[model samples]
Target: MLGIVLPAIITAFSLLILDWLLPGITIDTVTASVLAAVSIGIVNGVVKPIIQLLSLPLTFVTFGLFSLLVNGFCLWLSSAFVPGFEVRGLVGFLVGPIALSFLSTTFGHYLLEGRTPASLPEA
Candidate 1:
């Protein structure tokens, strides 16, 4: 439960940050941000695998980098369904996913996973 819920909340926070930093991403309200975050998680879990299977050839050709485009498309699709959340233009589609990925990874590693400087052994 914590594993699933925590990541979703973290993703919401990342979305909020992205909304603040990027003009292309708009999250109108707190409720919308939460909805959008859940939507993205659903899309990633349900839709992404199907898309990946279909795009396997392209993914292979691109050395797996094409997965990023798939991820961006999922984020864009979630925005379309959420009224107050909007990702505008091609730049938004591209940057939104990348920024979300970066923030989510950082949050998961350092925050959610409970890794801290004090926990590390000194060399």
Candidate 2:
């Protein structure tokens, strides 16, 4: 779907930028970026639901704030297997989701979707 692929590309590029900006985080090439993106999608699709289900009580107790930890864990897990994509230490791992989300949203709005429609015609 256009929605999914667009955001994925944004996340991949954001990871690349983060690697350049942040030491100990490295996304070496475009190939690595693609791999990291795919791995992230798989982890989010397959692992996240199970994690959320298991952590439901904690999620409720923390007012859903602990969900961020799950996102961080998934990011770390995806990075572990992807070559040339390395996120060292807790800072990179924890901030990964936030950075990706921010970048993806910005990129999606500005570059991918190309601004909101000014008007809609009647069907």
Candidate 3:
């Protein structure tokens, strides 16, 4: 489905960019990037919700900013399962997810716009 595949691709692109931009985030190859992207997608889909729920009070106290930390944790967790996808140190753990989130969101919005029904006017 486009819904799933598109996000994965976007995440991969984001990872590639992060690999280039950040010294702490190292993706060894294109294959590694794709694998990391898929791993991150899975983590975000499955694990992130549980984390959000468990940290609901903290999220509320932080006025939803704690969700960013949750995202970073998910990214760090994905790196552990993905070979050749290394996130070094605390900085990588924190910034990688935020960068990936921004890139994926931007690319998904731009790329999927034409495929979405909202792009079409009512009959």
Candidate 4:
């Protein structure tokens, strides 16, 4: 449970980056951004798998490219739940989520590399 916290926080920061990087996406407040991140996590954890399973045939037909739409759908669904967070148009629907994932992973990697339990204990 505690382990999940860092990734979620990282994701919120990544969303803030996305807000800066993409014009089609809007996150008005930090609190809204965090809520949007949590909403995205919930959608990914609870809804996306089911959608993936249902869309498996389409995914197979498209050689997995269709998974991008699925990912976009998840991000769109997440935005709907958080006030002041909006993902609009094709770029927001398609590219925003991919960027967010990349930013979150990169940030998480660098952050984790800098702070291990051993390093923390020393500091």
Best by TM-score: 4
Please write out the lDDT profile of model 2 over residues 42-96, one tens digit for every residue.
Answer: 9999999999999999999999989999988988889899988887777777777
Name the best candidate (by lDDT): 4
Model 4 clash pairs are none
Stretches off by above 4 angstroms in model 3 are 117-123
For residues 17-60, what per-residue lDDT tens digits would candidate 4 score against the true structure?
A: 89999987999999998899899999999999999999999999
- How do all models score by TM-score? 0.86, 0.83, 0.86, 0.90
Over 4 Å off, model 1: 114-123
Q: How close to the true structure is residue 17 of candidate 2, measured as C-alpha lDDT? A: 80
Evaluate all candidate structures by whole-model CA lDDT and list the values in order: 0.88, 0.81, 0.85, 0.90
> Candidate 4 — worst ten consecutive residues by lDDT sum?
114-123
Candidate rank order under lDDT: 4, 1, 3, 2
Choose 3 or 4, whichever is better by TM-score: 4
Residues forming the 10-long window of minimal summed lDDT in candidate 2: 114-123
Q: What clash pairs does model 3 have? A: none
